[model samples]
Target: MPVAGQTVGIDLGTTNCCVGVWRNNRVEIITDYHGRRAIPSYVAFNETERLMGDAAMSQNAANARNTIFGAKRLIGRKFTDPAVQSNMTHWPFDVVSGPCDNPIIKAHYKGEERHFQAEEICAMILMEMKEITEAYLEKEVKNAVISVPACFNDAQRQATKCAASIAGLNVLRLINEPTAAANANGIDHRGCEKNVLIFDWGGGCLDISLLTLDDEIYEVKASAGDTSLGGEDIDNRMVDYFCIGICEQILRDSKMPKDQVHEVVLVGGSTRIPKLQSMPSAFFDGMELCKRVNPNEAVTFGATVKAALLSGVKSEKLSEILLLDVAPFSLGVESIGGRMITFIRQNNHIPCKKTLTFSVCKDILPSVLIRIFEGEHSMTKDNNFLGEFRLDGVLPLASGQPQIDVTVYVDADGTVTVSAIERSTGKEKKVTVSHDKGLRLLSGRKRGHGYGTLEMYKLSD
Candidate 1:
């Protein structure tokens, strides 16, 4: 509502998406054209028309195969990936392999089978947000900051960026979901720093971010969670409990060890369930969860705050705060023995850099290849290969004799750049790793860099 291309923060969740705008010295979540604060993350397509949000959700049952939902899990993933294969059984819609092995949405619309990439479907949802916000502000909306899960790899982040681009929104930044929540609800102190714990259990992912805050300065201390574990898992557990009698089921379920904490801030609509509320009480010793902010809209509210800050908006409150994040996984290259040697470990603050020296494997070679990866896997083949670049002018010596400095820098913009230079010649080459090659599947299981047995690293508290 401020002006054209002004910053708007968007929470593009797997189950629901919300948009917020910063105005009048505060961030306000905008209701959609349908008067809904939280829009269902659904999209339906027919030959004649397309519907989004509640409109699309209404037709999901009748046209289940034509409606796309839960796209966040599939976006940037391959048809042969284990996660994709696991989620396939739950979706009523059809998913097929795409041109590059990326998962594709298959729907029979207007008497024909139409295919759409996950990013394309997500773009439609983002476009809906753009239209609704434009109507509310009575002006064009362009710039936005979208949030993604901390565990999302380069490919997923890239896919999200692509969706925003397709929606005609210029992305200001892609903040992690928990970090955004901490910005919105966890950091409440002024003039002093405090440790805050955020329990972000959303529809598709449960993300826990440990943060330190002083007024507006927010820093992530540690982060851990299960990407596939969230409110939906709780619901499934609830259903299983009820099948055997709720009271009996809860009694049979093993009690989890209680963790010490300061204040537990809960975000996600699923927190509204009475049963979930009851379970956490046992874990937290019955401490009251913070409800000062709306669970459903807190992430978006934080997003708007970020957009306001990033836009250089003039406000005394905005000027006093700082936000910082950490690299979620270890990034490095493969060792000769198939070991993963980490250059950057998890929880290292962002905009950080690390340099590692490497040598050529053979003598008198013209080039040295560095294959970058992200994960906590012990073996290089078990991690996610992001991208690779070569120092072509290398004056190679005997194996393990030549030195090439490989520097990996993850900037504040959430993009990775890897640079390699031959120590002797000072020749260098750099590659910015983002969406395009982030999720490229190695077809042969054997390549220049061995096959990556991709697995989601489930970090526990």
Candidate 2:
């Protein structure tokens, strides 16, 4: 890779977004118009103009319905997805369906109905970061490597890439969130290998990645997360606990707090709650929470390490580092009986492929539907649906008489491509996985009998 114009990296988080560039031998976060390094990932509508980041978040209290947050959660998801349906009532804004079945965020702007997609709203945040960066550097920056959750599937990842494209930036890569944090710390510099856990608890999601740092190559062994769980959950849980405490105080003198545990590495703005410092003492067996780095700015710093690496910048501390990530969850299809037939399992390395054959359940059926899902569960209802596609134009056949082979391959960038063939007729159908039901991905090669679909990045010369 050859060096070009100025390049930067972005941490496009669910609750906030920030930009950083490798400049003058260091990574500096671009400050927004509000004089803050990281801007809120929010967007709002007004009578005369649309506002983004801090300006948009400020309107949340009084104009909540017109202030859209959490666009990352809805990106590339169908209006009918379980995640979308469950969250429909969460915000005061209107969530409706688009002509293509994608969920649209709508609000009354200037007394008129305005609709926006999750990508569009996310782009607003990205565009602001771009402006802030250009103004700070006094030059144009048009390239970036954006970070997403490790658990983000192909559709979600593409959606994020689309947001960057919309913001007029060419996305060099889409990296994982925790992986970026690990890079920020330069954990791979140690001569001896060590296993470390990254507890990425942010406002919108909680992800844990187990990684082995081996000099310049970092390998992720496993990853698990609750996409909808994070500091916000902690806030509500604490609020409920406060009410419980009040009732207990009225009934008795007081209840004693529990003990604290050992070391804790905190990140994100919510981790700064004054109660968090003492709660660890009360709940972690008397241990205290560690805030070695600024919680709100850590992710962006890590992202810059990656940005520097991807853009061919040389640093004695970070040059030539490579990252290999695992599939955060299993990738497979739903059987006719609603059983999940997985082709890729969790923790499998990326850039892998698998093929499976199926027998028809009905006679003379021209098609079969392959609905994809990701998770550890065995049943369809228990897993996360990625998308679905129909393998049509099959030769008319009797029950269990036709062979339909489906080959799923995940590319280096985590884009998934599925191909189906009718052995009898030689008719084949291939689709790049998208979320309106057929576009998404996973990557990696076989670990054992089954492989995975997510790999971090390879810094090849």
> Best-fitting candidate, measured by lDDT?
1
Tens digit of lDDT per residue, candidate 1, span 1-461?
24446679999989999999988988878897668888989988666666678988998888888888888888777789998888899899888876667787787655556666787678778878887898899888879999888777777888898778767789888988878888777434455666666767789877767677767678777766656665666666643443224222222221212343455677788777776555555556777777777788888988888888777788876775778788877888776787887988877789889888877777888876788888998998889888787679877578777478888998876688888888888898999887764234322321323211111000110
The lDDT values for all models are 0.75, 0.70
Per-prediction TM-score: 0.87, 0.77
Candidate 1 Cα lDDT to native: 0.75
User: Model 2, 181: alpha-carbon shift in Å?
Assistant: 1.0
Q: Alpha-carbon error at 198 in model 2, in Å? A: 1.4
Cα lDDT tens digits for candidate 2, 219-318? 7666655566656667667534642343233123112222211233456666566654454345435555556666666677777877787778877877
